[model samples]
Target chain A: MSDGPAIETRGVTRVFESRKGFLFREKTRTEALKGVDLVVERGAIFGLLGPNGAGKTTFTKILSTLLLPTSGTALVLGHSVTKETAWLRPRMGLVLGGERGLYNRVSGRENLRYFADLYGVPIAERERRIGEVLERVGLTDAADRRTEEYSRGMKQKLHIARGILHRPEILFLDEPTIGLDPKSARETRKLIRSLVSDGVTIFLTTHYMFEAEELCPRIAILSRGRIVARDTLDGLRTLVGGDRTFEVEAYGFEDREIESLRHLPGVSKVASEEYGPATRLTMRVRTRETTLDDVRGLLPGHPELAVRERRTSLEDVYLDLVEEEAT
Target chain B: MAASAPAYTRARSTVASLRLAVLQFMADPQWLIPSMIAPVIFGLVSFELFRGYGPYFLIYAILGAGMMSMWGQTLYGSGWATGQDRNFGTLEPTIQSPTPYLYVVLGRVLWNVVSGLFGGLIVYAVVVGAAGQPPALANPLASIALFVFVMLTLAAIGVVFAAFYVYTRYAGFIQNIGEFAFYVGTGCMFPVVLLPFAVTPIALVFPPTWALDALRYVAIPGYTGFGWGLWGDVAGAVASTAVYLAIAGLIFRRVERQVLAKGNLSDY
Candidate 1:
């Protein structure tokens, strides 16, 4: 194995320019990537979590050699993305989200064969490889059907089959399960894990925090074109300093009740929302051992409130990180 | 691997691309049927209108319709292929592949020429069957040579059209206007001498004008092949083809760079 990282970036940035007016117009520039630096180790499933328009796709495009960075450099498998695209492209595969990427009028098998030929897979190996990937993605029965007849999930599976048709060392999956149903999404996740076990380094990006926590040992939270935090799940949980969130369900949540909860000794923040005749209150506190009792002590006077302690999940950590950036 | 390994690989890639292009074209009958029918209809109408002019007019109608069909297939087909790929969301992945994008695009245009030739042959069969006599060729060998050269020249121009289609939003409108312009400016339907004097320079610059004139000169009894003599017209067509091919190469490279920089390769 090589000592170098599978993928690395140093101060990568991308700026998109567009004209705004009808005739002679002013040029508007939007900085999509802000000197971002990242590294993905080989054989590791690294996840990048971000909301829409957070520059995740832009970074993926740069790494895949589909789009050039406006400045700085990115290397995939020790090859420069911009200068060595011809060398790098064959070694890396990118599967973008959405159902429209396939040739809808052709059968799934034909599409895979076309891509196999394009990637220059050995003619002798093409049929076996195509069959293997189709079966792996659980599309063998529908392989001969035209892609236009496929469901969204089936189309997504076909996308994955094409991406790995070359058997690339590094696979970049951008929101691979974006529109899949629950069962299909779970199946797709299993397929990704199997690919990783076969020693392909996966670089995944998704807005689903549970998906990331389930698949990735390490995750990076990106906000507004920048990576705000990167660490393992347990490491990120420590960012909140062992704080616990308690949910209080009640009726008629008055302003004074929320104020009282906020004034509690261990409480840091209290948020409340009303749904019809009922109200839900969330309290973020320093420690559950001391704060849970105190929260109960303060809540009993209301009589209408029921309190329960909740675990701090990765979703909470992600929202806190992104909300911090927004503020 | 041998020293010629890269060339061999490129040839294989080009062939695969051509297969895919042909398959896609065949699957879309809406595009193929109209392209084939337009030229045949034009030839039939021309033969009816000019029946008084003897067998020469029938030959003109056949060959002229064939040339016009080639232009329409090359220009409109190339542009629509790009648009369809973009709409189907396949352009990005195709561009992202390890093979050079130019081969994929040029391969598609080559197949379009092949299909256009097939369509032309159908028109020829109809005309010859209706007229009951083959058009006379003063120099059969030279006419055959010029036909090959003209097709190649037109194919190169098609490459240029493909590049513009890949890069521009107005590709459809441009293709429509371009096909009409080539039909009129190249004198596919009428002789250039009857056109305005101001239009003569524009008409002469297009290789297809010289190409059609050369074909008419050798095939018709009194036609004078652009008034440049046989060798002069042949040389002019060859030279202009080279120039157009060079321009196409440069344009393709420029547009490719712009598309990559702007991240608009798959935008519809």
Candidate 2:
């Protein structure tokens, strides 16, 4: 691999077209990606988070050379996905981990062995590498069993085992931990982190906010086929609102009272939700300029009031940014 | 950091996937029963129909039924494997690998030739049992070589049609629709002479038409297909097979690009 960002895209766009109707067969086009520009440094765990149709998988597919971009450009390890795939494919690994990607009748080891040869893993070390990957994924015991009998999590682990079997320089993992139990997901995250420490750049996409926050040092949020935000959690925290959120609950609060809370010093935004008889005002505060006492004081008329302060979670940040884009 | 491995070689991928195909077949070998049902019936029916054609009738039955079975496995085997990859969602990763997809495909084709031989045996057993005797060949060794050659020709055609599967996930449907057309066009059940004069040119396009004709000329004493004799039939089969092999190599590159461009490699 040449020297450059592990992954980079310049306004990359992908449009998918399909024909419908029996007689007319009108063509309908769906733009899966819209001019996405991003960069991922080498050896870092970069995460992509998105809604179901937000095109996270499409971006991963383009970078991994599985699909061609309709316009713009995507490069992996300084090689264009479109023209330099021959140079890029061997150095890149993709784990689209799901129930579908494995041969049901073959053993898990056989699946990895097949990919090892396809990726040109050295013949002398092929078996050892397959064994090691199976062990790393905690699948050594199940390696010889036919994959058809393996559970979804085991099949997912097999997907990961095949992905890292060749020791690629950059790995594209599209929701690698999806569908696994918490313990398996944690182990998979640990494996991903270990891969990063071993100098493999990881481009991860996941719906699990905590997973991304725990594993990815930097992340990009894709909303509506465009990247709404890309930065460290703190950076995104600032972009969405702040690193601190204050939750205030009461029987009720007036619109003017809510507006006053939104205008308070250090308050970036205020959102309200009703749960049965009570209302909760979620205030994103950037600094200590606003406190729980201040929120409580603004709604002093309510006898039943509960106020607390907590650090903004990644989920809060994600919803803030994605909701903003939705509006 | 782990040391990255080198690029894949065509030979190793071929062997590895060929082994995979056999392992998978062994794992769920029952599919073999369904695949043979049609050919076995065709063989038994051909035996009854050809029983009155004299001593040469047995050779006719064997050639007809054996070629039919080989035609199914050798031609549909690789395409079926590709379609299976699409369903299993394994096609995405396999296509993503550095090894050109054709090598992986060639592995399946080669394995199919082996399994296709098993198919031929099934048909042969059915026909021979129905005849209550083995077919007498004018030149048994020559006929054997020609039978294997016919299989290779079918394999060549198979390799090319396999490209169709790699090109689209719906290839199985398309191939299914064209299957009987192919059987008739390739003259798998009989000689190309039986096809219409206008369709003869289309029949000659497939390597099996020439090859099966060549095998019959060797196995039957008075068989004179196309009046070209055995050597001409052999030469025609060789040229057509070579052409098909060359097309297989070229078609894959184009199909790979087409599928990638359409973003439909995973559409199944």
Candidate 3:
């Protein structure tokens, strides 16, 4: 159907079987991806965020056709990845494992041309495109230089250039800015945005939450081979919404006095802990509704008490979600 | 980047890729020098040490150096290339491109062929030409055809070896074994006939031995004093090397399938 996503995986799983020891080793199995289902619309910048060893690379490999899923199916640009990989490979671009995704012996231009050939770029048009990509990545002058001579940021740019050489409809960029300086990282992000604007569907994976928040319209948080959450930034932000907690420092407060604050309306739970000679009271409430109104009514009774409110940010929500899942 | 254009643009790209590989070879003085120098040293040492066997010894020694050059370059260059791929993380990107895997494999093999030719020629110019017993193929065109056949067989072997290297992702372990095969099976250190006849079958399994035999037969045609009919043996070696090439291709495919199934293609 015309409605098919640019990239989709349904119940995909990958298991690695390896042997241990030297002479008398037993077989070992590692489950890298487990029943993961993902969908990215055409031209969408989809972010896949996970901790290291959380199967982000595994998922990228599967989508990029470098790997086969043990138990499920994936489609890239409407091509079935497992069954028709040869058909899918030409239209898909992949930059996996950062800067090492290059032929070090070849120059930047040569690397691009090599990929262009792999993609079946017409012979007549390859030269101009090669020049274009090199210039675009600002590696034109260094295009003739061996990749071994490239700086880390230069290598990353070359990697990006190689991935887009074929003008693929979908791109899988794994840790694209992994080792880049801040300026280069910003440049890479801008280039990624431009690629997206030109109808290129980008499937990006990174550990940088802020990058995801800035670039990806939708993100899936992965941990332990499972996707914990997949939603738009605002939608994910709402997932952790409920109560704002405040540490109310008072001129004079006792544990019994903190208990009095908890008894107020809209207060869900209250805990008091000692800091030096003072009692720090943390309260969890039930609404975005001003806790100050309740605190005002309660604090006036204790004339010496000071009231303050602390709301949970997205980072706190993410940590809490991951921690909660771990337990 | 430039404006996007039409499809079907690939031939120039493939050539460009080849050019890049060649340029890289020229720049790496370390590999370039050793790849050429080692064969010359082998040729000179063998020529000086053994002269009692007459022209047979000198001519066949040159053939041995030739086989060593081809095998050395193919194995060493390809092995180092495989290592560089692992180090640079270039494998995944190339795999993701629209190019067929076979084309990429061929591009790599072609690079090895170029390196072999350059290195072999250097050794030939030094040892055979200087000794005044330079090789002249009796059936020059036929010898060319046979040389290609033998090289393809060896290349297939290289591919199987390269695939194993890819799967293991070990740095230069495959090259070490390749270096061992060069010395023992290809008769680089000594004539293959000097190896026990019992080992002939095993040595014949390696393309370099057939390659050496074919080259010797071509280079030294008339003097079959040992009762070995030169051309007949050359034809037989060609046929068997073809068979070995087919087997190597099958092994390469099998290894590729295993690596894909295991999902360790990018392990390094």
* Predicted candidate 2 versus true structure: per-residue lDDT over B98-197, tens digit per residue: 9888999889988888877777778788888887888888998998888888889888988887898888777888888988898978877767787788
- Give me the runs in candidate 2 sitting further than 4 Å from their true place: B1-5, B34-40
lDDT values for all models? 0.80, 0.87, 0.69
Against the native complex, each candidate's DockQ, computed on alpha carbons, is 0.43, 0.73, 0.49
Candidate achieving higher DockQ, 1 or 2? 2
Model 2 is docked with a DockQ of: 0.73
lDDT of 3: 0.69
Evaluating just chain A, the predictions reach TM-scores of 0.90, 0.97, 0.83
Candidate with more favorable, higher lDDT: 1 or 3: 1
lDDT of 2 at B149: 87
Docking class of 1: acceptable
What's the residue-level lDDT of B226 in candidate 1? 60
Off by over 4 Å in 1: A20-28, A251-281, A284-291, B1-8, B140-145
Best by TM-score: 2
State the lDDT of candidate 2 residue by residue for A185-284, as single tens digits: 8888888998888889999999899999999999999999999999999999998789999998888889999998988898999999997899988989
Q: Is the docking of candidate 2 incorrect, acceptable, medium or high quality?
A: medium
